[model samples]
Target chain A: MTEEIIIAGFGGQGVLSMGKILAYSGIMEDKEVTWFPSYGPEMRGGTANVTVILSDTRISSPVLHEFDTAIILNQQSMDKFEKAVKPGGVLLYDPNGVIHPPTRKDIRIYKVEGTRAAVEMGNPKVFNMIVLGGYLKVKPVINLANVERGLQKSLPERHHKLIPLNLEAIRKGGEILEAN
Target chain B: MGELRLMKGNEVLAEAAVRCGCDGYFGYPITPQSEVMETLMELRPWETTGMVVLQAESEVASINMVYGAAATGKRAMTSSSSPGVSLMQEGISYIAGAELPCLIVNVQRGGPGLGTIQPSQADYFQTTKGGGHGDYRLITLAPASVQEMHDFVELAFDLAFKYRNPAMILTDGALGQMMEKVELADQKPRWTREEILARSGSWATTGKTPDRQRNVVTSLELDSEKMEQNNIRLQAKYQQIEENEVRYEEILCDDAEYLMVAFGTSSRVCQKALEVLREQGVKVGLLRPITLWPFPSKVIGEMARKVKGILVVEMSAGQMVEDVKLAVFDACCCVPVAYTGRMGGILPSPGEVVEAFEQKLLKR
Candidate 1:
């Protein structure tokens, strides 16, 4: 099975890192994975996005025109990637700061109040992880155990203490997700 | 499997250099490829393996440094993007003229002059058909994946020394920045002074002794006759490389009625296009040339005889397509050749490639 995903948001929203964590989790499960980012000037402060692919066989193109899932964090990303999602695919987003919500009736739309959830959890840094947890709730392509291992692999040794907090944020994310 | 890790293509290039016993890396940082030097600096190979890593003043200085280090029979390399690579052309020519073995990586970006920092394959003509002043050919390897990016460092260095000719890894910003799971090779120790002397002792300028004549590494031969002979010898070496060093990958070509020829990032896109086309009941195949300099003309010629039409896809405006045309020209086949691509860092999607094939070749 192949799952092609696009995670997009403002540069600091951890869009790239979210894709990286997912890719690492795929690798931990012995799946072929690729993480392709939108780099250079756009990454400075503009919209940032990453394409993550996990497949049973070797992956072909990292640059794709469509995605099986689009995890959009901002209104701009929702505006841009909502149409790019496959007809019957999934569109997950955070409702914070979004002016217009996704209106696609063909695809499954879900919202996770990640920004508010992170603030409530007393650490806004776990916003991306919360959103990731929401994605796992919907898809569950990768197991939670592998995701913990992925967190261990991706985070530095000094940051190991934050894994539990991140896991807490992830669980909160799964709990707060709303079907739209 | 030596060590499995998910790494960006540029970072893996540096890691591979360290693991493959590279002696020195002299490079100036540039976008889409600065991670190469950054990772090398972070690793500090000097502390572990005595490898020298320097930030040169400019691309010109870095390539000349490579030339100098290579003169001592050391595995040396430098990397840059398009405009920076353009600056190193003269030094690259000098290295090739001196017949010094070295690796030069161009993690290419869009360019005519300081173009976008995004990926593009526009350097196809410049790299494959002599970017430097004289008639010199760099053994160019085009890597489509991050894994190939890791694997080709040692391969390029080996080929460079095997022929005592400069070799290059011609990749784009897309492949350089993308991350993928890679199984890195085992670490190999750097060559000792004694080993360098023993292996390249015949002609290396490693402080000549009384047992042999002074070995002078120079590309300058003022005499016209001597220069002509030098060119002749270089041409012969290039011919030998063409015969033995051509590398390419064929996907589903046996039953294909049409074929697509591409390399690097474009090849990856074409792979998807091949699948899309096949799903639409189109019999298409893909030929990915791993060695861009050798051009894989023989295989293209052989494939052209069987296919009805061929589509050449690149990130440039029909650069490698010329070589594809030349390859098919000699086959004496009436097959048509079409070109499809994107420029200035925009990658063509698989749907676009499929549309181009149908529009140009099938006239639908």
Candidate 2:
């Protein structure tokens, strides 16, 4: 099986890193994966996005227009990517700053309080982990063991001590995600 | 199995360069290609393999630095994006004229004038048709995967030295920035002074020796007779390359009726489109040119005779299609030749590609 996902948000929201960790998790699961970012000035304080593909076989194209899942973190991302999700695909969004929620009826929509949960946990940087956890909760294609291994692989050795905090953020994110 | 690791294309290119015993790397950072230098800095190959990695002020300076290093019989390279590559054309032309061996990587983006940071194949003409000036050809390699990004660095260097001419790895922003599984090559030690002297001692500026006369390396020839002779020599070498170095890959072409020609990122997309078209019972095939300069024109000409139509897809306004047309013109005049593409940072989807094949080529 192949899972094509797009994660989008503001620059500092860790949209790209989340996709990276997810791709690494796919690697831990012994799967083929690819992570391609929307590079350039758009990554400097403006909107940022990344396309992540995890497949059982070789991946053909890294540049794709459609996605099986859209992880929207901001109003702008939702506005742009809501319709990009395939029919019956999952659209997960963080409800912190979204003014107009997604109204698409073709795909499954879920709201995860990723930003609010990170705020409660007293760490804004964990916002993306929570969002990633929410994605796993809906899909659950990759297990938590692989996710932790992925974090170990992606994070620096100095940051290894903070794995517990990140794991907690992920669990809280998975718990708070509600289907709409 | 060699150490399998997931790495971005640009980073893998840097690592491969170090592992391949590259003597020096001089490059200026550009969008979509900055990671090449960044990875080198982070790896600190200077401390490990004694490889010299310098951040030059401009692309022109970087290419000249490669030329200087290569003249000393050292394995050297420089990398830049589209606009920066344009600035290095003069230096590149000089390197070719002087018959120096070096590698140049162009992670192309949209063009004409600082178009966009998005991936593009617009530089196809600039790269294969001799970007600089005069009658010269850089052995161009178009890599479609991150693995090829790693593998091609070594191949580029080998080819560069084999013919004593510049070799290029022509990729795009997407391939440069994308991450995938790559098997890293084992580290090779830098060449010793003895090895350098044995290989390039004849023409290299290795200082005057008591036994042999001093050698000079220059492209300047005041006498038109000497200049014409130099041009003839260069043309003969290019002809040898064309005869022996043409490289390409044909996918599903044996039973194919419609042919699609693409390279680099566009070829990977075309591969995906081929699968889609096959599902719809369309007998489509894909031909990807690995070596753009030696260009597998003969194979394309042969395929043109059998296929009913041909579609040339690119991330530009169909620059490579002109070559395809010339290759097929004499073989099959009745075969419909068409071009469809996306530019300015936008990538065409498999659906769009199939639609173009059906509408433009199959319809005819």
Candidate 3:
């Protein structure tokens, strides 16, 4: 099975890191993964996006036009990537700051208050993890154990103590996801 | 097995160089490829492997430093993007002339001059056709994946040393920036002084030992006939490489009616295009050239006789297509060879390639 995902948001929102964690989780499960980010001026305090492909076989092109899932964190990304989602695919978004929600009829849409949950948890850094939690709930492609290991692998050794907190944020994100 | 880690292609290249027992890395910072030097700095291989990593003031200086290190029979390398690579052309030519064994990586970005910092294969002709001048060929390896990016480091070094000529890894910004799972090479110890003397002592600029004639490394041949002889020798070595080191991969060509030729990032895109065309009842195949210098002309010539048409795909305004046409010219003159390319770092999608097939090759 191959799942192509695009995660897009503001530059500072850990859009690329979330995709990195997901791709690493694919590796943890003995799968092939590719993570390609939109580089250059688009990454300078503006909208940034990363395409992550997890496949059982070899992945050909890291740059893709369509995605099985589009995880949008802002209105700009929602407007940009809503139509690129494949039919019967999942489009997860954090309802916080998305002025115009996705209006695609063919794909599945889910909203999780990831930013609000992060604020509640007293750590804004876990916001992306919460959003990732929402994605895992909707797709369930990668298991929690692999994702926990992925976090451990992606993060620096000094940050290992924060794994439990990030796990809590992810679980809370799954718990708070609302179908819309 | 070595440890598996998810890394960007540029970063993994540095890691592979260190692990492969590279002696030194000298390169200037360039966009889409600075990570090569950056990762080397962060890893601090000086402490572990004694791999000297230095940031030179300019691309010219970096390449010349590589030339100096390589002349000493040390495993030295440098990397840059298109514009920066252009600056190093003279130094590269000198290295090729001196028969220096070194590795040069071009993480190509789009350009005639100062183009966008996006992926481009425009440097294909420049690289394979000898960018600097005066009769020489670099063993060019084009890597389509991050795994190959790691693997080609050692392969390029080995080929460079075996032939005593410069070798290059021709990649693009897309592969440089993309991240993938890579099984790294086992850590190799750097070559000892005794090893260098035993292996390359005949020509290496290590020093003038009392027992042997003084070894001199020079590209200057003031005598016209002697220069002609030098060119002939370089050509003979290139001919040897052409015969022995031609590497390519053919995908789904068993029953293919049409063939698409591509390399590096374009090959990956064409792989997807091949899948799409097959789904749409088009009998198309992909021919990916792993070694660009030894252009795989023989394989393409054979395939050209069987396929009805050829489609050349690249991130340039048709460079390698000239080689493709030259390869197939004598095989079948009637068979049409069509070219489709994206310039200035624009990457054509799979659907676009399929569209090009219909427009250029398929009959309506």
> For residues A118-175, what per-residue lDDT tens digits would candidate 3 score against the true structure?
9999999999999999999999899999999999999999999999998998899899
Which residue pairs overlap in candidate 2's backbone? none
The candidates, ranked best first by TM-score, are: 1, 3, 2
Model 3 stretches astray by more than 4 angstroms? A42-44
lDDT of 1 by residue, B1-364 (tens): 6788999999999999999999999999999899999999999999999999999999999999999999999999999999999999999999999999999999999877988999999998888888888989999999999999999999999999999999999999999999999999999999998999988988799997888999989999999999999999999999999999999999999999999999999999999999888998999999999999888999999999999899999999899999999999987777899999999999999889989999998899
Model 2 error, position A128 (Å): 1.1
Cα lDDT, all candidates: 0.94, 0.91, 0.93
Candidate 3 structure, TM-score to reference: 0.98
TM-score of chain B of 3: 0.99
Off by over 4 Å in 1: A42-44
TM-score of chain A of 1: 0.97
The alpha-carbon deviation from the true structure for residue A147 of candidate 2, after best TM-score superposition, in angstroms, is 1.7
Fraction of real interface contacts that model 3 preserves: 0.65
Taking all chains together, each candidate's TM-score versus the true structure is 0.99, 0.96, 0.98
Identify the leading candidate in terms of DockQ. Answer: 1
